[model samples]
Target: MGASGSARPAPFLRIAQLLRDRVTSGMWSVGDQLPSRAALSAEFGVGDNVVRRAQEALIEEGLLEGRAGSGTFVRAPRERRVLRRTVSGTTSPAPAGFTGTWEARSIAKVPAGPETAFRLGIGDDGMCVLTTYEFFTDSRPVLLATSWEPMAVTGGSAVVLPEGGPLAGAGVITRMRHLGIAITRVVEVPRPIRLNRDQAHLLGLATGAQATFIERTHYADGRAVETADWVVPSELWDITYTIAAPPPGT
Candidate 1:
């Protein structure tokens, strides 16, 4: 607590995060002038030195750019990612030389993350079965898939079930057919994301490599049944969605 009876940030880290959030949220736009040092100290209830340290940290993090005569300004936003997602009744089999292809890798039961829960419409007690398989085309390594299946529909049997069940297949349609479930609709959410070390190792690429991220959802009786995140190396894979045209006379 300072003289004004206000609590200050723990040290430089809290201040750094505060500034980062502001910049990320567009509260401080690019080329925008920063508050004066004295004003910042007053607002944060910290000393001038502490404010300076926070400013320096932001500059180092590339969140702010300092001008010789003028004050610091927020950095520009990073480039956006272009993603493509598609859903179809039929899916091609994995290319030659792959052990299990895309869908045969299903194995252990794992907890679903927040996004998975929301997509699958399940609560904390909901369990998800996750599996991953690396794929190749023409003797060159390519896509990596991390698929999730909700336990409610599978009656927890899917979690302990081995990979070589009747569910193994490229398209969810085939799996649904084997499970005796009729798929009513399919949804695909496309996103752009960089490959992490684990994913890179699986895909035979370097960490931080550019990749197209795609999440395709399969629905049964209007309920989101399963979701799969497909990661493809920049040069190895491509996805195209075919949107139907308008009616003949309209």
Candidate 2:
């Protein structure tokens, strides 16, 4: 309840739900043009901004699309591919049946930013090796990644450069193992994000398009060894997780 002592939904959300019901109830079919904001505002006795905000929310959900010089229309649902992954298992670059190719550039002696410093448990003045990656399938970009490792951990070592020398293209566990670091576990946090120009351009998506951003960190006995950020367009993929079962007879 608000200060007025009555519970009420936000104006935009209320309007959005009404519009969604219309579509689902057969009042508006796929490819049908949506009512103008002016019409909706007059019908709801609300301002035009309220109606527009509601429409924009549906557009982000892939339910409504705006055509240039034309009105808004209902959009068909996207056909998505499933990306299944296990929490505690060997990491693969992509899901099965998708043999994608990637281009990566590793730069050494880079300074760690605030977020990287926090993740790697290092000071603000810590130096790092930063690697950027772009993965493609069917000649179209689908994934973007950037990884950071503290230089203090791999400096002057054969495994310093992530994609160079022997054991090149090998994952973090193998490389860290060569350095006598036992990578115990990996942690990942997935969140929603709006793609910037650089990311959207490579993926052929519009600026500010929605995507899944995953921040991953590899740990060795509670010490963070590597951190990376990965992105996948929301319209083209859905992530599925498989949880490991506990031991029997605990």
Candidate 3:
């Protein structure tokens, strides 16, 4: 506070802010290696611990990533897009050259668990068609989802199997619409969870790594039609939803 009688920010915080400004200004491009801790410390007139703390803060903010035996480097931002669900269909658009494909397997006539039955508004003893999906983008597995539909709703229909028939790969809303059940609304609850052993193996993530979990339900004419759980690696995807606001006076 001697120079101008104003207190300076903490050393690490000041450094962190400078680094954030550099990243935001594109001074360091994605995948660009940052200066070493020793070099930064010397340049900034701080100790190595201060530089380390600053770098750690950037890493937590997803601006930098550390590699074993290498160094910290800038991380590429994930692609962000809106998942639009409309009467025509449900579509999630990806960037050019990024094809989002999924592999799915359906198990028919499975007994619904208590939670599943409650979500679907069916008896605990009711049977369901359970389908598991693994989604890939650019040939890399990135997402996993499981959907349960009460057999009473789609047991005898041609779209009984979610990934079968002419409506194959079409989302639940579209398929149910074809069955004369118009899906009017969907509810989603998103939470954070650590990846389990199976999820880690499939998504190529470290066990216990943070991931995004979403529980979604589809409602048709006040009746629940399908419920699903979607798991996505936090580093790979950014999920966004856009809803139109109603006009004034209805």
Candidate 4:
């Protein structure tokens, strides 16, 4: 809330979003000249000053640029690459044609955060094995993952530490299977969010950049054996989901 205390943004902010939508929707393209502010003002039924403020906002977001005499043009187009997602389970490497590598740190006996505890069906004070991952393709970071597995499920077992022991680098599916736990289903929910300072730093992006947040949980015996938060930069990657089909009719 600002001085006005109205929850709604100003006219300029709304106008700016409309302009950005055109570029992102491919109705406008890189290097394409935008309609003059006066023209847009007439179309939007707003004052030219409001239009200018809107354009300035888009420029700050790197979506457009203003020329001294040539007027405004679309500077950057929202181009995103595809990242394949399979239902089989992820905690692994990137797909073929791309080399994916990640650095992970596992901390044991850590208290679970509220969200983590809820996802794992445990109390807030429950102990969990938290593993944070920084996944990259080549030298460019693409994805971030933070997994929390209830120690009640893996503690005192060979798979206590997700990144250690004989099962080092082995994903949740394999590790849980070795412990005789059959993961029958996986559920993922996606959310749109802005990058925090730390996440933006690792992804080489500016703070408040757009990203996709995925809450993925693996279920075994109707219990959430492992739950993870995966972050993907919207500026770079588009998530593609691949669903496997059954072989024959029952």
Candidate 5:
């Protein structure tokens, strides 16, 4: 169904809907390669903008993924990430197999700057401990993470953990959980960020590299517990999501 009596909805929405139907009906299965933009535009009778909009919407929904030189394709299904909101602030454990070896750079109790204050909802007087780690996957640097925790919660514990430890094993969320804080939800936001010199060295890229900036906030008992910023190179990884329709007839 579409707006009003129009069988052909808005071009991009129609494309999205049609693609969704095909995926739901199993016409396009996981890992199936999609036609090129030109082919899709010809088939849908739309311009590149419409097709681009359609592709971007599906990408945001985690259905289809686009590669630089490679065409769009159905992403392999992954575990459903149910967004849970709870009082005991906790974060989902790090994705398994993301750890190979890590280099611990520095851990210090630092002042919470403007960005940190806004993300953690801390006051000007509040201080946060910053922990920086260079995480490698398959013996290559994948992400450079800097975690910020309120001094009241993790001030002492922050400097205790060793550098380059297993992300899941030495993850802060797990540590917070043990301290009686249960993370009920995690908020993940990704954006394009300019990489600095230090970030470049950690990720094996040159200075001024473009990277995906990931910011995550962990919550427990309706309050933010921890926040982290991850700098990941554009060429190193792909993000996938699965979108599905309601099961058969309600």
Candidate 6:
């Protein structure tokens, strides 16, 4: 407590900030073991529990790592890749400096479930194509995505199969363009979620870890033709969007 009787910052937070400063200022090098909890507690005039809380916070932030049977150690900085979306309804690939590869498997003529139908604005009985994708960076899994498109939009066309034919691997906008469907706008909504068991296994993350859930829909002439959901591990990627302003005169 201070002389003025005002509330002080939580002990754990102050300790965490002190430790973070040491890390950022090069006082602690990568792979260096942090002082024991007892030492830190005595040095900071706090309880051991407070020291533990501070260390745990750093672990979650990827600044410190705990090794089983070994002491806590500083961790190497994480590489953050950006997923960039443009207002032209086009998505750019990861920046050149980022090294990652994506694998996708697609199924066609699948019946759209009720939720999928609702998002596509189609009948519940309509059939659609579905594709699942997993992305890896530096041999570490980081992203998972599932996409759906109504068959009524691309059935009997050269782009029927999202991963087959001449337009294979081409994005939805380009494939739809080849079929004369001009997508003018896309809507995206993002929320935080916990990684489920299967998603955790696929992305190599701990179950219940923090992640981002994004729902996206593509429109051509104000009609929904495609929809998708992306599961991205927050620790592995950063997302950015670019919106172009409307022209003058309304």
For candidate 6, lDDT tens digit of each residue in 42-74? Answer: 999999998987886787677886655477889
* Most accurate candidate by TM-score: 6
Structural RMSD, model 6: 6.8
CA lDDT of 99 in candidate 5? Answer: 33
Better of 1 and 5 by lDDT: 5
C-alpha lDDT values of all predictions: 0.64, 0.81, 0.78, 0.81, 0.66, 0.80
Q: TM-score for candidate 6, please give it.
A: 0.67
For model 6, the local distance difference test gives 0.80
Sort order, lDDT high to low: 2, 4, 6, 3, 5, 1
TM-score versus the correct structure, for each prediction: 0.55, 0.67, 0.65, 0.66, 0.54, 0.67
Candidate 3 lDDT over 1-250, as tens digits, reads 4476678888999999988888889898998999999998988899999887787667656687655557778877645433432323363211123367878999999999999999999999899999998877656567798999999999989989988887877778778878999888888888999888688667655556678898889899789999999887776666665667799999
Q: Which is superior by lDDT, 1 or 6?
A: 6
Better of 1 and 4 by lDDT: 4
- Cα lDDT tens digits for candidate 1, 57-152: 675455665554466667553322232343443543332223333434654557777888888888755787777766654333467777787866
Backbone clash pairs for candidate 2 read none
Q: By TM-score, is 4 or 6 better?
A: 6
- Per-residue CA lDDT of candidate 2, range 20-135, in tens? 99998999999899878899999999999999778877876778766554777887675577766553435333333446788889999999978899999999779999998888
After best superposition, candidate 2 residue 247: deviation in angstroms? 0.8
Cα miss at 214, model 6 (Å)? 0.8
Model 3 lDDT-worst window of ten: 87-96
- Give me the overall lDDT of model 3: 0.78
**Cα-lDDT of candidate 4:** 0.81
